[model samples]
Target: MDTPILRNNFKSEEYQINMGPQHPATHGVLRLLLTIDGEIIKKVEPDLGYIHRSIEKMCERDSYQQIVHLTDRMDYLSSHINNEAVCLTVENALQLEVPERVKVIRTIIAELTRIASHTLWWGVMGMDVGALTTYFYGFRDRELINDIFEETCGARLTMNYNIPGGLMFDIHPNFVNRTKEFIAHFKTKLPEYDLLLSGNIIFQKRMQGIGILSKEDAISYGASGPVGRASGYSCDVRIHHPYSNYDNVKFNEILKTEGDTLARYQVRILEMWESLSIIEQLIDNIPEGDFFAKTNVVIKLPAGEYYQKVETARGELGVYINSTGTKNPYRMKFRSPGFSNLSLLNHIAVGGKIGDLVATMATLDLVIPDIDR
Candidate 1:
């Protein structure tokens, strides 16, 4: 009987896996090298540069006007906002004050871009978490916004509407009406989005308490947009810096303290509402004046360093320019929000499941070109 004693020993070893360079959940050509112990994530390392085009270097060779269009390719979802950032930078370097009309118009269009971006994110996020119906609903509304942009700017996704001193052109005759129509339509549909996905028990179970990032960590990792806001970081460029008539509008910078997947998702959902409020405030009050400030055909900046930051759909997009009194920038660099938000992936994603990683990444709402730039 004493000789019948036995023991059982089993050990679990960590293994490595690649989530994507082609995976749909990643949303682009982003490869995440993951270390896993069965269902648990031990580490997440993002392998970027697959889609890098060295846009900053390209800016050195191109005129400032040419550089505006290049930004359209960076964060295509926030193309108009990206254009505005560079335009503001150049205008500031020249000490140019654009017309009041241009300011209100730019603000309205930018908010529309924000809503369009958030709507797309909501749908894609729902799809990522197994709700396919949200994708159709999301795009259906986005199409209306796209139509407005096309009528005004002649393009939808990569709209190079903003130039150095002002808009490339005046707003279309139907721009105001069409934008109002989108606001009216979306106001009703947004509630439906909540009923469909935001309030779902299953979604709450998956999102709540998952991939928790603290306020300190969020700031440390340079998180911004909804990612930083979810962690209670008050880093909204619009609120803090107040460029492009944002100072005139009254809207809340959406924030949450949970710092989990659900908190991030809710912050963006609320932000769409705030975008609506901002557009409403400026749509009718747009002052009558020239669409652009007068500028020379060959724009040149004073020999100095200039920087401008704008609140894009993803977050703060800072355009830094070094000028030697030339048509082209001596050196140009962009501090894209996606790059900073992406940096926090390894920080927040460790210790969650693979499914949790997908949900967390979706909430981050990354546009790979923004990061790779």
Candidate 2:
């Protein structure tokens, strides 16, 4: 289906409005220029880098382990995945072997992070569309996940828990039991989310036909995760590339043909359930072994480059490190998926109503820090 898009807005010369750089809807420090006629958006141009700190460039001056803290700030919601990505890449550099138990533990933590992140997005999206009470439900549920994380890693948001060989520590003895209990309650709570927000008639009317990105457009713009899945593209790195025993599991790649904000919401909702299923299977079968690989505290790299891709809350994040047999890296580059996902904003929101623009942006879940970095 052809999406509603701006046509000759420049020739028509519509009124322009600045949507953000200060608004709550931009997530963090995002600016959207909206060209409007009455309430409909004639065009939207996103201005970023308000939060850029040259994090990738800073990595070259620090040791390999020091870079983990920098990744924590990129997508503050999914810190575990970021830490895992950096550790996996460095491990690949040294050709280290990880134990089965370590792999299972890492997988469990990643899923917990996904649930917390999605819960936040769900409530925030509902609020953006005018339902404020749903936000409380999301945060309440997220607190549980946060508690779990805090007990495991000693930090809630910016955990640099993964080392090059293994994890920061073994999963707590109480961790598995607590996880199972949480999963049961979470399963009960999922239906309440659908009743509260997903099936709301007003939300459907607002989201159904707005901000559509066709499959080809999504692929051409390099969208990933829920955005691409909403457009019928199966582009999940966890499924396609199979990192950290994702290959040994059975799961579906959620996709939709509608390519609108609703499609994105549904994709995320279904993914939460899939993540739960993955965790349940692995928690009981966690093998008994070392948490980390054996390596010296002071790390050095050979004369080569190491690249790693890990699925984050947003999309595929890549860490590329080049070393010339030195303690410090020669070059470091971070490929952030939110940057390209946010780039698609102008194309998708140009012809939509002003109210829909907020909903559309929320569905995309733009992490401005990730984009700027």
Candidate 3:
């Protein structure tokens, strides 16, 4: 077939270009078959499974506590969010009620994780659009947050701090000072990022109106986090269904109606600020109480089904458990955010430039283990 000439809008037929199972621009193992006319793309098919770690099968034999660690590896950037999700679900099934202090702690860790996740995204967004400095600036703040996590949780990327009922341990006495310090330092640096990347001309040119995901399509495909909010869904789990102490803390869910790459980027950047504010409220009010809610080592639940949902940094994470009054669950299912967001890629990628496809994919921020499992 003769190569179809697509217009600059990328709505016409075009010759296909294989971008990668291994490409520098992908940031991870993502293979894209892009059909392009000049620089614009008419179609895109994302080939994933480059990093399938068999998480579901792995969880079948592992203990409930052990599965928390496994969830961490699934979304490596948002490890605390992943840990909180599994913990919340397991706790709910076991009918374990965490203390006020514990809920506050979980909220703190999850929100910090959200900031870290978005920081990673901010850096990658800049890199994808051809600005390296913005990437460095983002990580510079992230490193401080990392240091705080490492001090308390004993790990940075995959902390696995949350157990079934609550945290593995109480917040370190120094947790407050370190958190406040990082917040103060990070707030000072946020404006610098705005000046560097969010306000940059090149970024606007690359992102504005590019890889636009309409409001309806974003919702239908189960897009979450910034992707859904950017489309004006007002669908944040934090607002609609408060988990942990999220209801206690007050914050606005960042939103934009554009549903394009720029809207996604803007929503995320704005959210980091809200996350910071939420932390400020909880930092002082964290009630002094027990950390982990005690549970039997050999967990047994009545024969029934229990479902729990938590707002992860990425989106809604639901864990469905079927119990048969046994040592282990009869069945367990994780409704992962990465899977939903990644599933919608083809819909948005159909009429964008090969490069825009990449920009769009990065915005989704897929972590493959969740999907493959």
- Tell me each candidate's TM-score: 0.97, 0.95, 0.93
lDDT of every model, 2 decimals:
0.93, 0.87, 0.82
**Residue 203 lDDT, candidate 1, scale 0-100:** 89
**Model 2 clashing residue pairs (backbone):** 165-293, 166-292, 166-293
lDDT of 1 at 255: 88
Clashing pairs in 1: none
Rank candidates by lDDT, best first: 1, 2, 3
Models ranked on TM-score: 1, 2, 3
For candidate 3, lDDT tens digit of each residue in 1-373? 3355434445645687787767777666777787777776666677777787777777766777788898887778788887887788777777778888898888888889889888978887788877888788889888988988998999988898888878887777889999999899889898888998888887888888877888899889988877889998888988898889988888998889998888888888899999999999999788987887889886666779888777777787777777777766677788888878877887888767677787888787766665655
Q: What is the lDDT of candidate 3?
A: 0.82
What tens digits encode model 1's per-residue C-alpha lDDT throughout 103-182? 89999999999999999999999999999999999999999999999999999999999998898899998988998898
Better of 2 and 3 by TM-score: 2
Top candidate (lDDT): 1
What RMSD, rounded to one decimal, does every model reach?
2.4, 5.3, 3.8
Taking the tens digit of each residue's C-alpha lDDT, what string does model 2 give over 41-68?
Answer: 8788887778999998888888878888
